[model samples]
Target chain A: MAEKIKPPRIRVSRRIKKNKVFKVKVKFDHPSFTGLAMADDTTEPVFNRAKPVTFIRNMLVYYGDELVSRLSLSSGIADDPLFTFKLKATKEAPVKIVFIDNFGKRWEASKEIKFKG
Target chain B: MVGGLTIPLLSVIPSSNDAHGAVFQTPKDLENLTELERIHLPKISLPPVVEDGASASIVCSVDHPMDEDHYIKSIQIMNFADPIVIKGKFFLTPVNGEAYLSTQIRLSGGEGTVWVIAECNKHGKWAASKKVTVAAGGC
Candidate 1:
């Protein structure tokens, strides 16, 4: 089933030095469930067993056209996880992140790189 | 006759490296991890104590060069007690200013240790761990 997914919140450090590394922070709204939590013990079949696993499986980070980082995630991550990583902006470009979930859903967000003097 | 088969056989054989082009690898066993050089070890920073079942902030980084030829490949957070030992793994590139990551992880009930493993393309793997005490009840 298709569902609406809000774009991820992305924030890039302002006033970055030329050719210097800067920080990028991203937050996603996701359950990130490990599928280990049981919905109910009294039910004939546990509620969790019937439900499919839902979590972000892969993440890719890009600075402009160049691929910067890739991540393989698991259920160990908490709900609505926040991630912070470093990136060096050689040229002015958008820093984009794409996340793929177990259900084959893709969500992405980007922010323009603003350089400082 | 033998020469005719040679061409087909050579093409059928797959290359040793991955065809899909995976730049980094996850060490599954201790032997594979031991084979890597112990340089550029990761430094882990987190509170020494926390409330039970509370989310703890974790910051890890490696002081290494991010050159095209050599750089930190990935950073992994692990806990032996968790259902999945690897909490998360982040693969990196030269564009990343440095090998640094800041995130949060929830520790299981009770006190235990958490480990951070860093992998470098040229240098093998380096690891560091910290003990976190989870207070049973604070409310």
Candidate 2:
């Protein structure tokens, strides 16, 4: 990214609760520019085949080794996208979230937490 | 005139609604199969009214067993008004652990309908829809 942003932060609430549905919160600092506009318009040198892949198009969230949820996004999504979801609190598990932009670049993060029974 | 029998020209041409390659635009009168209805369910989740040129969300969640044995096969979305149907597909397995899906879509101004169909890997298919109204001169 041209502009540096803070790293993404993730938290799972009621981390130690058993049999309770887990709530996940994720936030990242970044500009999600859209590639659609730049895909067609190339008037300026800055956009010279810049390959407008500015916005994220796919997101995958996994609990443990299993894929639990995924989001298929587009330019319509806001910048620094925030997402929340629920997974039946199984035993202590590891979580991984991955984001992919239109240009085929991928960003991913993983977290490990403990659950109390 | 292969055997002196005149072949009707109309019979040789495929009907406009029966275009084979079209994934959308299913004809309402075809009687051979319910394949179209199978792909696009009978009912779906949609907002009663949506503003013009606004982003709309279509929910394809159906209450089904999400255990290792039973789960939704996949979710398919389509809109009859737009040319590109078969918008996207979300494949599901027990690993997903959730029985729901939501897809964000944009309408091309005015009234439009979006369809959702969820196929159960073990059970069958389910369908739903949403009706939208856009503001004047909006999409």
Candidate 3:
């Protein structure tokens, strides 16, 4: 349970394409929370991470209103992760990429993709 | 017994940063690594000399098919000088038709080697590294 949601830096290599399988890289910054242990009656640490952990949970990508892909992530992912892939599109639309942290906080960013059909 | 000893050996890992060590970010972890001969390491693009503290985009690319059954699982960037070696990691699926990822990373002063490793979902792991010289002062 996160009380606050932090915005992340997102970048899309290009905003326009030729309606074919176009390659674009999606980059975002995320922190992984690591809980610390304390001795005493308390079993849980005061705050989960002595330092912010770079673990992220899931990434939901949307092409306009339609979902394009969903990626499940783990602490195995490094901090400030970058994902690159080719997009197959037929027309112009807005590409929305949402990063969901392990705490369930959601931050979203978007890019306008113009595919020359 | 081999079975009983193996369990303890696996748990007796070094007191390292297991919290965020992703995978092959250190030499100890690379001991018995799979030498993915067929998988080619990505082509890394960066300036010959990066100013210290200045943000520089480290682009890595590879020519691989991004099919549903066969695809690049993830990519990792590591630097030995960095306190935390893992600079970054990129995860991908078949939806993304190619294997490429670029991101900005700040380097400390002096010379260091940047290693790039990619893992294909079906295949093992492939790696490549580049020697970078960070200028004395960050611009």
Highest lDDT: which candidate? 1
Q: Chain A alone, model 1, TM-score?
A: 0.83
The sequence of per-residue lDDT tens digits that candidate 3 reaches over residues A16-90 is 555456754566655442222222325432223344454567777777787656655555344455555456664
What is the Å distance of residue A97 in model 1 from its true position?
A: 0.6
Give the lDDT of residue A104 in candidate 2. 78
Return the candidate ranking by DockQ, descending.
1, 3, 2
| Local distance difference test scores for all models | 0.69, 0.53, 0.56
lDDT of 1 by residue, B3-105 (tens): 1111111111111212122333333342333333223656677666766433556777877889989999989998775545677898988889699887666
Give per-residue CA lDDT, model 3, range B23-103, as digits (tens): 443323433423443334455676667664335457676667777788787777777664345655666666555666545
True contacts kept of each: 0.69, 0.06, 0.17
TM-score of chain A, cand. 2: 0.73
Provide all candidates' interface root-mean-square deviations. 14.2, 16.4, 13.5
The local lDDT score (0 to 100) that residue B49 gets in candidate 3 is 72
Residue B16 in candidate 3, Cα distance off native in Å: 25
* Models sorted by lDDT, best on top: 1, 3, 2
Pick by TM-score: 1 or 3, better one: 1
Error of 1 at B133 (Å): 2.5
User: Is model 3 an incorrect, acceptable, medium or high docking prediction?
Assistant: incorrect
